[model samples]
Target chain A: MPRFTAGDRVTVLDLGKPGHVRIPWFIRHKTGRIERYCGAYPNPEDLAFGRPGLPAIDLYRVHFPQTELWPDYPGPPGDTLEIEVYDHWLEPAEPLT
Target chain B: MTPEPIGYSADAVDPSRLVVEGHEGADYYALMTEAIHKILLEKQVLAPSDTDRVIAALEAPNVTWGARIVAQAWKDPSYKARLLADGSAAAREMGYAIKEAKLVVVENTSSLHNIIVCTLCSCYPRSLLGQPPWWYISKNYRARTVREPRAVLAEFGVAIPPPMEVRVHDSNADMRYLVLPKAPADAAERRFDDLVRIVTRNMMIGTELVEPYRDRG
Candidate 1:
């Protein structure tokens, strides 16, 4: 089962490691809404080193508001950016105070 | 200095003695990959027939088919919805198998604009779209597009109004994406074939818009 579903608010994990992981640095630790659940694929990090990447992981399409992503984002308030993120790097976003 | 050794001018060096060889930029990597391929083949890990099939798939024809899909989407609302919902599946139905690496179609609406870039590397929709433009894979484009997309788009002669939202998608993860630019204002009267003719490679990449077809000929 996937860690998240469409419309779920999640924050990317910020684990620093030396690897061939697909998670980009820009979206690390940032919160976003899962736009949709992209199909699962083999773990690329394990596959990069020629290891057997068994147990495919789910991928998600995540959308983040431009304002939340960049402090000086120079676009309309409605602007949004979307990126694909794997399940392992995503965690449930905390409730708003 | 002794009158420079008679007949010993710099240009007098034997033309045959100098090894003038053109270098391939990817020679080393190509050689390494070839070695790996041969080993895999020897071990029966990858059959030669499989290699041929994969190569054929990579070099498949229909490099400009992306434009055809875009044109069809523009003329058909239901098709466009299916494309946005499942780009890879939509492409497959159009006879292009862009599987494994998923495809996402981002639409450029009236109020929102979308551009794509692979910040870490050039992760483009190669199966359906063919190779990306040289500039799309450049370091400058990748770095600047995510940070200041409007500025980069402006350089490509795509200046968006301040009120319009410019959303940039970084193709850094599993799924690849394509930009579906909104049809030109005068497209209502244009034929489908005419619309396809005006769709340039850059328009699908979101660096430019769909230029309306002008019947000059």
Candidate 2:
């Protein structure tokens, strides 16, 4: 079962694992809504080291407001940024005030 | 030294002649790739015909593939819905069997525009759109697009109105994105081929809009 569904707010985990992680540093600890599930994919970290990549992880496309990502973002207030993140790196986010 | 003609000796002309730029670099990679290919061929890991097939696929032009799809989507709302729902599967309907990374199509509207970038690396929809443009893979584009998309887009000669929101998609993982720019006026009345001419690669990248074809002459 997937950890998150579409429209669910989530925050990317800031945990640093060695070697070949798909999670970018910029989106760590940032809150966003899951746009959609991108299906399960093999763990790239394990696959990079020649291990048999088993138990695929679910990936989700998370959409975040540009303001939430970069404080000084020059784009409009409604401008958004979307990124694909693996399930392990995301956790349920608290609701905004 | 052997006696040579003073006006134009073969060695002198050869030394003075301009050589191809990046020749050594190109040759180095070519040799390395050839060596790898030869070893794989010798071990029967890759058949000789495999290279031919890959070359053929690479050589297959992407001149009208994207345009045709965009035009079709404009003419048919149902097709547009499917394209927005499942971009990869929709592409497969057009005979492009995309088996690697998934594709997501974002539509541009009156108040919303979508642009694609891969900050970590250049992950593009190569199978359907062929190779990405050089500027799309540049470090400047990757870094700036996320920070200030409007400014970067302006450099590309695209100026988005303040009322419109520019959504920048950072393709950080396996999923690729394609911007579905809004169709030009009279798109429904235009012929498919005529509509195709209006869509450009830049438009699909969200750096520009689909302009109506015009004859300057």
Best by DockQ: 2
Off by over 4 Å in 2: A95-97, B1-32, B41-48, B211-217
Which docking class does model 1 fall in? incorrect
- Summarize candidate 1's per-residue lDDT along B1-217 as a digit string, tens digits: 5686543222343424533233347799899999999999999999999989987887673446888888888888898999998888888877777854878899987777889999877898888877787888787788678767888988988877766777888888788888898898877688998988888878888888764223223
DockQ of 2: 0.28
Interface RMSD (C-alpha) of each candidate? 15.0, 15.5
What C-alpha lDDT does candidate 2 achieve relative to the native structure? 0.82
Write one digit per residue (lDDT tens) for candidate 1, span A1-97. Answer: 7767778899988656457767766677789999988878888888989988878888888999877877787766777788888888888896633
- Model 1 chain A: lowest-lDDT 10 consecutive positions: A14-23
With a 3 Å backbone cut-off (N, CA, C), the pairs that clash in candidate 1 are none
Prediction 1 global C-alpha lDDT: 0.79
